[model samples]
Target: MIACGEKRLSQKRKRPNILFAIADDQSFPYSSAYGTSGINTPAFDKVANAGVLFNQAFVAAPQCSPSRAAILTGRNIWELEEAGTHGSYFPKKFTVFTDLLEDVGFEIGYTGKPWGPGDYSKAGWTRNPVGPEFNRKKLTEVPADGIHKTDYFGNFVEFYNQKGNDDPFFFWFGCHEPHRVYEDGSGLKSGKLLTEVDVPDFLPDNKLIQSDIADYAVEIEWFDQHLGKMISFLEEQGELENTIIVVTADNGMPFPAAKANLMEYGTHVPLAICWPAKFKGKRITDDLVSLIDLAPTFLEIAEVENVPQMTGESLKDILFSDSQSKINAVREFVLTGRERHTHARPDNLGYPSRAIRTSDYLYVKNFKPERWPAGDPVPESAKQIIPAEGFKELWPGYQDIDPSPSKMHLLHEKDSLSRYFKLAFDKRPMEQLYDIKKDPACINNIANDSTYATIKKELRDLLESELKKQGDPRVLGFGEIFDSYPRTSKMREFKGFNKRGKYNPKFTQKDQQIIE
Candidate 1:
């Protein structure tokens, strides 16, 4: 807790461990490191204070499945075929870095979520997606209460203390927090008094929104605190010095704009790395980094050679050296995309959007621009019933929702608020470009503007070149690429997170409807 003093020299360095801590629904807004929000995250603060915090860190996709898929594999989401979007379907052919690392003598293990929305066992995989289970305590600890799962952190320590000492670890500490359906007002419990939670100016500044943000901050803190404890554990175990500690979110915060969209709030994540043995490069780097590069980063650091085909560059050079004068940044831009989320909306729709995010702007070319961006509108049958409100089914648990009064108010107004919140969740913009510096919210698109024509064209070109390099199906035609790829049973099944069937996945079962 004392002001970070200079780290004096240590004795012989051991091959460092890699501690990858990923949080769910986390946005770049809160981390004190970003200096944007007023939310206090001392744990993340400590990491940023000690290490290099990437201001423009992004995942390959907005939603969890593809994002995680990209991280596990060193390729872009599209290159992985059916794993193109969340829980869509991932072909079993792709090779994951976890399996690769394990093959190379590193002990890999994880708890909590792994490559999701698909059948893990059927994927031709031997162990759990993360390899060797880490959540044993949860089998008995998590109550019969179907609403919750076991605490991932508690189970991790129990597993690691027993299994990790033998070899260097590539442990993935995944936290499913701040994601959804938390106990309201949970953030208020941990001495985090949110008299004022810094919220984005785009959202309505009512207590409802602020309280929503406060609850989110609390969950983020919960994840951060657990990670802080884990860090303490590492320090106790003498692994802190060499371990590459990366604290980040899978994608962005799960608000209207963040989770599913390719906007800054969605793809722009908070990444801070603290590797005591790496380097003392104290300043923040604006060089763009994608989660896809994670495999190469790990491979480079561990000195593994001739890995699978990779589009990602290693951060080894960036992390270990002081080449501030070099022109070789990670990449000029990072590409992001999505295959599906909710089911197709009214026109029986589905969305397939592709975008390229740069340091200055975000250019997205919506392939299915004609379809609703937010799946189809709520089912026509549900249209008669008024929309339900009160945080829309998925409210945070940290808030002090005096349900008696609050529920009454929410019940009567749920319909209106539901419809209100539904706006952002509804549609599409064809060719969109936002100057992140000026409009961080991505509310405005200057794609058609004459003055910004050159910037747009440049960005557009960058996107096309990158997509072509990555071999996106969209270039050959969305339907053609998708049809050519042939989705597996899992990716074909659409029953999105929204189970109402409003946007039921337009899934064509493997044998039932062959694309050829």
Candidate 2:
């Protein structure tokens, strides 16, 4: 018979550890756990089966830096000022949750990609906003085509070992998978069949596109494989049950009309959380959740005081509740937006956009509709703006769109495949709306349609009101300040000249012949 003292000791609870595993540029419906067939993600599946799988999880923004900033601060993109735009500085005033966790005796560390593509030091941050780095470990056998070969599993083991057995910890495993610049034929080499690839409607169905997607699958598998190893390590240490494991991605798949766009694929991310000590397993919820909610959720779980600046609500109620029904009916809509994605445009201006997504509809407001939606049509060559010779050379006009087989195909067949090309790269209207249920691809614009006018107005009003309440500078009539923010990355030169030796026109006007 167990002693009373031993039983009391066994029943004692410790603060929950946090394991945040975020994939770079991965989208929902890509992981096999989410019913995607081409990719296999046993790790994500394990977490889903062991806890709650969120069918509708979204990021605050569609770009990397801003999306991650929102996840770290639990605030909207526009609220972040310089940090709100891509490749800009992270201001120190915006205290990250990790810093808060670290102050309260949490052993926090991160490996691989944390908060980046921007300078954190410029903001006087001593370390990366996520946490101190732990990427010294290396991998032996990794795909040559993949991005970083940081031994994420090994580094995590090191981090775990450094923490005492009784210490509560927070580890960020940011995998740089499935981003881009994939090795050609890596997927085929890995035995990923082309037929198994599920191509999105926006892109043409062809061998080249299939192969590209297969390569993406290979990278995603790599991320999952590492995650499985980490889970195994946690289970071995008997820390699995008490740990809060959150698996998701920063944004959507890196492709044309995705990634940087506030479209369905761009913002909708796969999410699964496991905390065996507090919640029942095998439950699925359609409750709309924002990635920003994660910051407050972590603070609440740790019994830490939430910062007043955090606008996102905690998901603790939804996560801990036994019921499978919608945890909060108020969580019906999620807001996602985007600023500069890359220094692809002239003067490093970003195509500012904001969007609101409900169960049935998606409403997007392109603030600078006259500007090239994708990117400047002509490449700012060596700081010299060039004239368009022919459509062939200038196929992928919008430099914001990542160079891919599908992108090239669209560019090559833009004349013949006008509709598809337009859907991916053409200039968009000021207001765009889509009935997501009928058109998940977001190809159909119903903003001007008489049938959706009511829905559009409702969503638009809600989105703008929220922006105002949040003090978004864009809506506060200081929107031009976002364009004026200095880009930390190398500036692409295109602001100096036009064909007639006239100073290059600001990209906001629709009359700019360079873009037209």
Candidate 3:
């Protein structure tokens, strides 16, 4: 009787390890698993094949810092005051899943980029919110110019070595690839044919754009390469099946109109979660999901009691269920918004906007519709010159959009490609709606069309109602509070900025301290 009781106790389920791999600035449908041409992502495809491939996964915000913050806190960007904007301070008051896991006997560490371009120390945290660093590994040389030399797999090995034999672990592998400022011809240099790349409708379909896209593919491949190596290492260690592998991107591609804007290419990102020991494999789910759900999902798996007040719901049911269809029916839509991205607008303002995306439609509400959706025009208010040397002048406005070869092409050939340029950098209406089933590119705005008036109003009402429920200051008539949040990034000199009468002296001053 005693032997039988001991055997029963020993058979209790062991907690699983977690491997969360996130790519920086990658779009949905860009991975080879999604049948996107030119880019090859075997590691991402492997994970998807092993578990479930989420067909509709979106981030809470399109920008990097806020999007990452949302993922870390299991809350919407608007709910996270300072952390909601790019390069703002992270308040330590909000609980993170990593910290919770660490307290519960899990060894947590992260390699490469974590929640950043922002300061967590200002919030009084001892280390990065993700975990302690495992970024000491460095590569002697990189395949391309723009790629980071941080050996992500080597660092993971370092983190793994430090863990106790019986300890369950959580690792964050953040890849800072597929972002911007790529080597001009690295794609061709990598033997990728230009014909393999397909330019999106929003951009001009020419050699320049196709080559740019191909270059972007190269970086994505680099990110996938490291992920493959990590997976192989785990398999060799006989720990592959017991680990929950979560692969996704922080936001979207760093193209002219994709990264910062609340379009399909902006918030929509690739997601694949795998856990062979528990969840069934080869299931592709088409349900709409958000990255904000990640924190709650992690906490649920860890079995941590006293979960905080998080806005996002857990995906445990969807993961455990074998159904390919919607397991959680309440997740009918996901909300995305932006407060500030870069110091682009006058007075260091941001283009405040909120949007809600469903499976069939995307509705946007631009609170400050008159403001430029991209950024202010080039040639600073103080001076104006075409920059005799070239089109690649430093700080050549539209600062919201990252500086890229595609952006320079649009600016230079604005006359010939006026439609594309305007689409990339233009003021939008107060309300915009797109039938995503028909126009996935979001080129046609049917919000004003009488035929779809009823659907438009329904979406608009739903969006505002949800935002209000989340206590979003934008919808609460306290929208200006976001602008007052101190921006920790480099301030750009734009029209009406730093002017005596126009702007506040405190905001204009350089190196403003965190407002506790």
Local accuracy by lDDT, each model: 0.65, 0.83, 0.87
Candidate order, lDDT descending: 3, 2, 1
State TM-scores per candidate.
0.82, 0.91, 0.94
Model 2 TM-score? 0.91
Which window of ten consecutive residues has the lowest lDDT sum in model 1? 396-405
Top-TM-score candidate index: 3
Clashing pairs in 3: none
**Predicted candidate 1 versus true structure: per-residue lDDT over 146-191, tens digit per residue:** 2236566676677667764546778887877667655555445444
lDDT of 2 at 319: 93
Ordered by TM-score, highest first, the candidates read 3, 2, 1
Model 2, position 109: C-alpha lDDT score: 98
> What is the lDDT for 8 in model 2?
44
The candidate with the higher TM-score, 1 or 2, is 2
For lDDT, candidate 1 versus 2, the one ahead is 2
* Candidate 2: 10-residue stretch with minimal lDDT: 496-505
lDDT of 3 by residue, 406-437 (tens): 99899889999999898889889999899998
What candidate 1 gets wrong by more than 4 Å, as runs, is: 1-14, 36-38, 138-149, 164-166, 188-195, 323-330, 344-349, 386-423, 478-516
Candidate 1 to truth, TM: 0.82
Quote the lDDT for 124 in model 2. 83
Root-mean-square deviation of each candidate, in angstroms? 7.6, 5.9, 3.7
